[model samples]
Target: MLIKVCLNGGRLRRDHPAVPLTPAELAADAAACVAVGAGAVHMHPRDADGNETLAPTEIAAAVAAVRAACPGTPVGVSTGVWISDGDPDARWHTVSTWGSLPAADRPDFASVNVGEPGFTALAELLLELGVAVEPGVWSTDDAEHLAESGVAARCLRILVEIIGVPADLAPSLAERILTRLDDLGVEGERLLHGEEAATWPMVEMAARLGLATRIGLEDTVSGPGGVNVPNNSALVRLAARMGA
Candidate 1:
C-alpha cells in the first residue's frame, strides 16, 4: 500500500506548530517524510499572507520545492472549493491557468472533492492538461456520485476523506464508503484518510483494509495512542510503522 504524507492543508501555525506553510518548510518536511517511508506528498500552496491560494506562482513554487526535495516521488495539491469561494468558474480559471505552467512547476496530480461545486468540469480540465486527478469522496453519497460521473477511470485514484466524526466512527464510515463504491463498480486504487480525531483511526482502518492510506499534520496532530506528534515526518513514521 502507498503511504502518502499531506504536508499541510489550509491550516495555520496555530493549528500545529510544525505545519509547513512556505515552500522551503514544505521541501524540508517533505524530504523527511519521504525518508521515513512516505510514497507521495500532498499539500496546499499558500500565498504571501499565509492563506491558501490557487495562484499559479504559489502552486509552482510549492510543487518545485517538493520535487527538488523528494526527487521522483509523486506530489499532489488540493483543488478544494474553498480556494474559489464556491465559484466553479473561478476554480476552473485557477486550475486552467495551472495547466499553462511549465512542466517542472506542475503537480503530479491534484485531489478534486466530488461533492464540491464544478467538480466534473475541474476533473475534465485536469485530464485535458495531462495532470492526474484523485477524486475525493467524503461520504457514501460522494462515492455514488463519483461512480455515476463516468470520470472514475480517468483519475489517478479515489481519495476517501472522512470528516466531522468521532474517531471510533471512522472505520464504519470508511467501510460504508468502500462498500458503496464497490456496489457502483468504482474500481481503482483508493486512498483513505480523515481529519483531526478521525485521522489515525482511518489510516489504521485503511491499512487493515489493505488499501492505500495517508498521514501528516494536515490529517492529525497526534501520533499512535493519541500522543502529540511533533511534525509531518513523525506522522509518516507512525503510519509506516502501522502499515508494517
Candidate 2:
C-alpha cells in the first residue's frame, strides 16, 4: 500500500506556517516526508509571490526540486477548477501547454476532478504529455459520471475524496463509491481519503482495509490522537505509524 503526502494544496503559508509554498521549501518537506515512509507527494506550484499557479515555469521548478530532493518518488499536482477561473477551456489550454516542459520538470501524475467541466479533455492532454492522470471523484454523482466517461480504466488511480461529511458517515459513502467503480470494472489503486474532520478516520480505515491512503496539512492539520501537527512530515510519520 502507498501513502502519499499532499505537501501543499492551494493553501497559503498563513493556513499553516509549515505549509511548503516555494520550490526549496517543497523539496525539503518532500524529502523529510519520504524519509518518514511516504511513497509519494502531491503539491501545488506557486508563483513568484507564492500564489498558486499552473504556469510551466512554476510547475517545472516545483517538480524538479521535489524530484531532486526525493529521487524515484512520484510527485503529483492538483488541476482544480480554481486554476482557470472555472473555465474548462482555459484549464485545458493551461494543461496542454504543460507538455512543452523538458522531461525532468514534468510531474509524474496529476489529479483531475472528473466532476469538473472538461475533465475528459484535460485527462486526454495529460496522457498525451505522458503524465499519468488520477481521476478524482468527490461525490456519488462524480463516481457515476466517471464510470460512464470510460476514463477510470485509463487513469493511474482513483482519488476518492470524502469532503464535508462527518467521520461516521464517510466510510459508507466511500464504500458506495468504491462499489460503483467496482461494478464498472474500474480496477486499480483506489486512494480513500477525507478532508478535515474525516481525514484521520478514513486514513485509519484505509489502513485496516490495506488500501492506499494519504495525509498532509492539505487534508488535515491534526495528527494522531487529534493533536495539531507541525508539518507535512509529522503528519506523514503519524499516519505511517498508524498504518504500520
Candidate 3:
C-alpha cells in the first residue's frame, strides 16, 4: 500500500501562493513530501500561465523534477477533460483527442474520471502505452458501476474520491465507501482522497483501515487539524502519525 500526497502546483497559487508550480519549486516540495512518508504523489503541471496542462513537454519536466527530488516515489497526472476542452469536441475531446506523446513524457499513472465521455477509450490507450490507470470513482454510483462492470481489473489503482455537499463526515463516509468497494469485490489496493476539507477525514479513515491514503492542496489547503498548512508535507506528516 502507498500513501500519496498531491502537489497541486499552479492551482494552489491562487488559493495559497505558497503552493509550488515551477519545476524547481516542485522538486523542493516533492522532497519534503517524501521525507514525511508519502511514497506517491499526484501532480498537475502548469505552463507559464499558471493553469493546468498535461502537455507532454510539461509532463516530462514535472515528472522528471519530482523523480529527481523524490527518487522512486510514483507520480500521477491529470488527464481531466476540463484541462482546456480541446476544440469543437468540448467536454468529449480531452483524453481522446489529446495528441500522442512518448511514454517518458507521461506519468506512470493517470486518472479515468468515470462516466466522462471517452474516458474508457483513453484508459485502453493508456494501458496499451504502458501507463497505469487510476480511475477516479467520485460518487457511490460510480463505484457501483465499477462493481457491475468489473472495472477494477482494468486499472493499476483505484482512487475513491469522497465528494458531497456536507462531505466526508469521517469514518462514516469512509466506512460507506469501503462497504461499497467490498460489495463491488474490489480486491486490489486503493487510495482515498476527499474534496475540499474532507481530505483529512479520508486519510484518517484510510489509516484506521490500514489502506493506502492521500492528502493534498487540491483536497484542502488547511491542515488536517484545521490549522493553515504551509505545504503538502505538513499534511503528510500529520497523516503518517495515524498510520504509525
Please, what is the whole-model Cα lDDT of each candidate in the order they appear?
Answer: 0.90, 0.89, 0.73
Would you estimate the TM-scores of all the predictions? 0.97, 0.97, 0.88
TM-score of decoy 1: 0.97
In candidate 1, the residue pairs with backbone N, CA or C atoms under 3 Å apart (3 or more residues apart, or in different chains) clash, namely none
lDDT of 3 by residue, 1-244 (tens): 3678888833656798668888788878888989989898788888887788766677778888887787777888877776755432443344433346655556788877775656666677667667788887776777776665545787877778776634536556666766787887886777876767677777777777678877777777887567987888887888788789
Compare the candidates by lDDT and give the number of the best one: 1
| Alpha-carbon RMSD to native, per candidate | 1.0, 1.0, 2.7
- Write down the TM-score for model 3: 0.88
TM-score of 2: 0.97
Poorest 10 consecutive residues of model 1 by lDDT? Answer: 217-226
Candidate 2 whole-model C-alpha lDDT, 0 to 1: 0.89
Error of 3 at 86 (Å): 8.0
Clashing pairs in 2: none
